[model samples]
Target: MNHTPVEGFSKLSKQEKIDWLLQEYLENNQDFKKVLEQYYNEDADLQKLHDEFSENTISNFYMPYGIAPNFLIDGKLLALPMAVEESSVVAAASKSAKFWLNKGGFKTTIINTEKLGHTHFILNVEPHKVLHFFNFKLKKKLLEATEAITKNMRNRGGGILNIKLIDKTADLENYFQLKASFGTADSMGANFINSCLEQFGKTLKEEVSKEESFTEEEKNSLQIVMNILSNFTPNCIVRAEVSCKIEDLKDDSGISNEDFAWKFKQAVTIAEIEPYRATTHNKGVMNGVDAVVIATGNDFRATEACAHAYAAKSGKYKSLTHCTTDNEIFRFWIDLPISVGVVGGLTNLHPLVKFSLSLLGKPSAQELMSILAVSGLAQNFAALRSLITTGIQKGHMKMHLLNILNQLGATEDEKKYFVNYFKDKTVSHHEVIDEFNKMRNL
Candidate 1:
């Protein structure tokens, strides 16, 4: 399938990129071309806006935009929009939502809402001198220097809140970090945080150079490494929990309520003690969190990095969620550093993102953090329940049957027949293809 490379691929217009790629690789496949074109919005203006989101835009890559309804959070009903391609994610979330709807739904609390960034630099000054330079008086000077950069953020009731000097001389020779915390309000504040850090880095170097108390060696030794935001925002924590009497867990799954609680707790316990299991366990949690984050135009990549770092905060990777059963009551919850925002970035730009935000009544960043945490908790519960009882494959494969049918090019009638056929049977891609071929022949 090797083909000659095209020059200036990035410079090509969207249509030209599509034409060249199709002509080079996809021969005589007007059907494939039409399928891609059909996903584009009819509005030219909106299409153009999407095209400019990234370079070399040939077509819009689509994920199934689904809604998981019946989520009761903080006494409010929310139908979360999940943009994902996985088969069982929406189903799992929906099942969890319905199961907990009558059990007081989910409750969320924002413990703290502070984002962090770092101005990494090398300083060979005495430890005391370094500490004194970042003391109360000097910290104010740092903020003063970045006042112009933080003007808009401060006007919006958010800006650089504090700067702390961290000593890392033991870890690396003369290494240090300037940690800055910010109250970004409703924005993710990556750009704002970075801009402030850059200014602080500049201010720190200047302050050192002019300090009569500092030796010439200390001034020359100071070198700015980088200024950036840290996604592992432990201070921006939110807790989401769902609790119900064990007796209330009765469902069609045939498992007793007490047994269900026991098994679910055990599953979570394994994740806590075993890093191997914990990795995949946390991935399942993100399956729910990332979907809602992406749908609402938040940075899922950042959230993923923060969540994983939080899991390993104890020096060992562990589960993000915990389950407890006491006095005939069952409780499942997760505490996650959910640094999400409901404004800025794509939130205000993308039409679907605005609609997603509106669906949740346009929550503040703290509220959104709670919602995202609960989603992860709910998804984990749903997956664990399936894993311990009927087995994960049973429900997952059923949801996956449609993808198999589509892959084999099943018509509407064939799809209906195969869907019913596979409902009472196991599904496999090869089996689906074989049955599809057999049906066509018949």
Candidate 2:
């Protein structure tokens, strides 16, 4: 699909860029497939993956939230859907990306993905061949366990795509691993696969029969490492890109494109070398990625853990993404495992989550992944532009005005006045109090 081409790149004006993007998204946003109800039917796997089981208080109330607007992704413009409550984040992302839009808008793309998953069980036994027992006899059982998961995935044109076993550091003395692969369909598949593993594990631990004299010691030797979801998701990899042109900044207060570019680079540089800064930088990345993940009912914790873990994999925590420029065109890129899906998940549960998923319509896993990649890029652009331009405090302070206004016991109109007033001034708490007193006296 041809897009408006990140406006200011060649010779387009910032308004020209935003106009083209808004027009393009309005045209395409309606045709997508969207599912709003959880239609449960018998399948080999799905019944367990989205298991609400008995009511658990924790998940019962973590409803979907919003990130507000001002970001666009893949071939669409979005206010950027988010399910978080950290006050400044959504506004910060909106403010930053809006700033970039005036410089020609963000350009982004998402690449396809491949996957691998592991199920490790640590069993320390007197005999050495306990781990070896499965190699010869469990082949059929492994296939049976895996095959049980294929029906749902296959219906959607994917299934037990592959399977393998991994050995964690054997030198660690008591560690071992068992891993399996099941094509996740258009969902994260954590529940689907975990249920299969749990049921099969019960079968594995149970005696083949009472006819065979299997000792209690043998049964007790088994130890479950984790029969839950995995953070080492490689099946999905998302890559995104965003760029703007020097001419896009013509309307900025007084900064040059080259200066803003340098400033943005310096801010990213801090994130690269400093862990303290990197966490925030990476948080900005997740600020975009996690919102969409939660809206679809996928696990946000796993995505968060894996994302930062990936950024710090080099031992020195650094940026999960990098920004670049070629003469007049500035660009941003990020690659990370964002395991997510729309089927067999909470995407079908909870009133609002299901509603949010429907609002997005039905998107293929890869297609949805592409959308996420673009959000990440737009979010990163938002953060960098703020740092380089008027600085972080400008937009942050505007969103923060509400918190302070509430504290001052301002009426609704008074709060609105304060927010506009706060947007127009340099910030300090005393300044807020002073403004409050002036308004109250009036």
Candidate 3:
């Protein structure tokens, strides 16, 4: 089986690409080709739009889009759109939302909404000389150079907030940074920030070349390394929290409200201290966050990177969520540094994404940030509640039972029977398979 690289793959048509893949790798399996085409949008325009979203398009990969209803955030009742394939994420989020609804629901605060970009360069000059040049000459020129790029943003009350010169020579030889902060209004503003940074880079080089205060050697020594927006937005912060009287925190697990509150706090405390537990703990939180982010046409990868980095911002990997019981009032909260936009990107392009945004009443970027933070907090609360009470697997495995039955090729009637059978009994793969086999045999 010899496989050789092909040329001009991107030049090929969609059908041609699929044919080449089939002949080269899949042994020309028509069945597999059919599987690929099955997921394509029936409308040609929509399919073409999806294809242009990335390079080397072949087929659209699908995921389950679900809704978790009854979310009360900051005195508003909203249902979140979640695009995830995992079995229990939507269920868990919905359960948590209902549990907290009567207890004043989730309260969120937009702590900050400043996004950052950097123009990194290497300059073998004295720190004071560089700082003097930046302060006296280059900073104003940088802002002036980006006026064209930022006029629209400024009109919307969002634009370049400030730019600072950072000296990083100790960390690396001849390393310096021009850190710029921005407010992007309702958009994520990656392109806007990057455009401004690149212009700043150009202006810095131009200013250095013309300045009489700098020696020719110093001017030539300055090399622009890169200009880009950072995904690690620590300053773009949102806090989501839920609290209730300890006596009101009752559940079907038979644990007393006080006992439940104490145990829940203890579980969160362990996650705060233990890296291993914190990793899984945060993953559960993202399960909810990413789902909504994707459904709303935001960048989930950037959101995840920012969140994980924030969890470790305190010099150790710890939980994003925190718990406290003050004078018999039990409280759980999460402070997330997530930057998401409700406009631009796929928000207007994708049909489902448009529907998702409309479903949320067309929130601003700040409101979306609060929504994401609350979703994550709700997910964490549900997971912690289960862990402290009946255990994580009982409910999770029950949700997972359908997948197992489907794997064993169970019919709808069998699925219904097993669903009822496992209503009281514990669910496991082997046990379900065993019971399924016995039922079929009988």
Q: Write the per-residue lDDT of candidate 1 for residues 263-326, one digit (tens) a residue.
A: 9899999999999999999999999999999999999999999999999999999999998998
In the range 300-327, model 3's lDDT, one tens digit per residue, is: 9999999999999989999999999999
Instruction: Locate the minimum summed-lDDT window of 10 residues in model 3.
Output: 211-220
> Of the pair 1 and 3, which is ahead by lDDT?
3
The candidate, 1 or 2, that scores higher on TM-score is: 1
Cα lDDT, model 3, residue 308 = 97
lDDT of 3 at 380: 93
Number of residue pairs clashing in candidate 2, backbone atoms closer than 3 angstroms, sequence gap of 3 or more or interchain? 11
**RMSDs, each prediction?**
2.2, 16.0, 1.0
* Model 2: lDDT to the true structure: 0.64
**TM-scores, each model vs. reference:** 0.94, 0.74, 0.99
TM-score of 1: 0.94
Tens-place lDDT digits, model 2, residues 210-311: 213335655565566665556766546777666667555453658886887777777877888999999988888888778777776677798888787778
What is the C-alpha local distance difference test score of each model?
0.90, 0.64, 0.95
Pairs clashing within candidate 1? none
